[model samples]
Target: MAAKQVKSRQRVADHGEVFTAEREVKAMCDLVKQETERIDSRFLEPACGDGNFLVEILTRKLAIVKKKYKRSAYDWERNSLLALGSMYGVDILLDNAKACRDRLYEIWEQEYKAVCKKECNDDTRAAARFILERNIVCGNALTLFCVDNEQQDTTEPIVFSEWTFPFNDARIQRKDYTFAELINAEEPKRPKKEGAQQTLFDLYPEAKPEPDEEGIFLQQYITHYRRLSENG
Candidate 1:
């Protein structure tokens, strides 16, 4: 059956919200076949209504992770986290944003449970949910501002959490940057001085490194997950 395109006619008129069919989504994604299959390739959907595109991208990436790392629980968990981190989305509607995150988490949880079975637990599930909460944001992509949850009318700069994996350790380092700064990283900026050109670094400042205390907490969290998996 063809999925319902929009919730209501009023929504279509107000937000110009129309969902792409599954077939069309596949056709468009096929254009970037290589990137879609690559585990670490990052993709951002500016108007990701209910995450039709992001869901498909995650499915593809997860399939690759499964093929390569399914046998090792640690490898599978790490690669799965990497795959989830690579996708990002923004939607103006808060409900859509929440739905998208829920959908993505559901997809990941189902797969993890099926493959890992007894090994899948609450800690791993919570990690997946945490990644989705950061990745799929409720915001105005054009303004690069997130809607304040407490006050719907107010907006805050869209700060994204970036996760990095180190080769020597299992700890994932995190950094934060405003969406505006990240997107404008490559755009040419007006010269700071009359005769001087602006460098890329000047255009986009470095991401804020996580605080030392937070880093310690994050490592502890990961260690807890490892200990749970081992005890199981």
Candidate 2:
């Protein structure tokens, strides 16, 4: 059974679906680096089956910092680790989660070796492990519970947290927001404007409207705007 399981995972890896290759990973990292201007950008991989995206992100971020500051390689390396916090991930499978964390630490170890110009000790490896264990949590990405349908309330936005585009409208007091909260907020009515308007309730109207229909509808609008902002 163990062997068969290994083979199955290998097949998945070969299909270029689960464990990503170094080159493709590098490409993804490059795209993120180019598009984002956040000094320490945060990235989240919703279905992070094995942390491939997060590892790749760390590699690119580390390289960027190293190029900018060559002299203080140690400090740069620490900064790179700190930057990993910005790179979030979520995986349902426990084994996959562990593997993902191990791969990230391995990448960190390799980077540390290259930066320090010397072999990394157990202490350094332990430090990397510590961070990985703390950050990589096992939980359902869509485990939000609606405490009050009308009001804006959620356990917390996890891996799938989204942001929306900017609004030139001065009427919108809160320009930015999240999809979940927006769908749950009290939008009495559609803003007196015309443009792209998509709602979760529209997608799943039968899913059961919250007690306070207005609050939840308006909340949905806020969430929609927030998601657009993030993508924009």
Candidate 3:
């Protein structure tokens, strides 16, 4: 059977929003068979519509995680979180973005519960949810700016968190960067002065360094896991 469609006809017309069928999603993903199977390999869906592509990618990664780490709960949890961290998405519609985040969380939560059972804790689940919120965002991929749900303005640049585990520790480290800077990192050129000659690369935004405190703040924000680890 074809995959269920998520958006209305008007939405499809207005935003050109159409979810890909499961079969096609799998077929296209299979073309990059090696990357999809590698747990830490990153995948970004520029026009992800309710995460049709991301959901499948996460599922594939989790399957690998399960096979390799099933016996070790710690390994399973850590690797699963890593898999979640690697899948990113951006959607124009707010509803689609929220739905995609929830869908991805549900996929992760189910597997986590299956493996961890009574050992599954809320802090771990919260960490997974937090990762999803940052990874899958509501934004205009073309403009590289996030859409404000209340004002429907594209004024804010979409910032994504990069999660890392230093020295195989349980602590999660996060660094944030604007989508514009990330996508244009290699090609950005400074804008010409009033009388200077123009260049093609000048059209791109110049990359800026992320604030040092941003990581500290993110670490503090997701304190549930921190506190739980301390207590344990």
Candidate 4:
């Protein structure tokens, strides 16, 4: 059976909601094969309707994590979370945003259980959901603002958390920035940060990514990987 590309005629008329087929998604992701496989590499789908592109990227990233860390449950858990944190998505429809998060969580859960087995715990599961909740957003990608139940733009801006394992330990650092601001700033070249596998500026040099004149971010905090639910 073929993957359904159109959900309904109303969705297409209202929001132009059409999912990419599996074959096309895979082919598009294959174009960035190396980046998709890199555990900490960032990928954003501006209109990620039900996560066609994201799930493919996550599947590739998890395969790498499994291949490299299957021997160690600890490594598998940490790297898997890293892979989860690296993806971001936005969909105008609330249902699509929720579906995207659920799809991502299921993918991570399946691999986590297969690799960690007895080591799996609810805290880790909560942490994965936390990342998905933060990464997958319901908003208008054009306006960079969140949407209401009716999919109308709200006053609140769309803010994205930049997640990082800054200390080479269990601690995960999160930095918040408005999506519009991150896209507004630009640097001629990406900088290599001390602890960041890839900072916002590193992953997206165009991101001014600083507290100074170059860029302005919202909040910064750190917590244990499993306690990411404690974060905002």
Q: What digit string (tens of lDDT, one per residue) describes model 3 on residues 153-231?
A: 4656677767666436665545556776676543222232343422222322331223554322111112223332222
Ranking by TM-score: 4, 3, 1, 2
Determine the backbone clash count of candidate 4.
0
TM-score, candidate number 4 = 0.87
Predicted structure with the largest TM-score when compared to the true one: 4
- By summed lDDT, the worst window of 10 consecutive residues in model 3 runs over 215-224
The CA lDDT of each predicted structure is 0.72, 0.49, 0.74, 0.85
After the best TM-score superposition of candidate 3, give how far the Cα of residue 170 lies from its true spot, in angstroms.
0.8
lDDT: which is higher, 2 or 3? 3
RMSD per model, one decimal: 9.8, 14.6, 10.0, 7.2
TM-score, cand. 2: 0.50
* TM, every model: 0.78, 0.50, 0.79, 0.87
Write the residue-wise lDDT of candidate 2 on 13-105 in tens digits.
642234556667667666766633343676767557678778767777777766765567545544554555455565655666688788887
The candidate that wins on lDDT is 4
> For residues 132-218, could you state the per-residue lDDT of candidate 4 as single tens digits?
998999999988888999999887788888888777888777887788877893322323234532333433344333556637566
- What would the per-residue lDDT of candidate 1 be over residues 11-123, giving only the tens digit for each residue? 89977789988999999999998999998899999988899999999999999999998898777887888888888998888889999999899888878977788887777
C-alpha lDDT of candidate 1 relative to the true structure = 0.72
With candidate 3 superimposed using the best TM-score fit, by how many Å does residue 62's alpha carbon deviate from the native? Answer: 0.4
Off by over 4 Å in 2: 1-31, 35-39, 118-124, 144-232
lDDT of 4 at 29: 88
**lDDT value, candidate 2, whole model:** 0.49
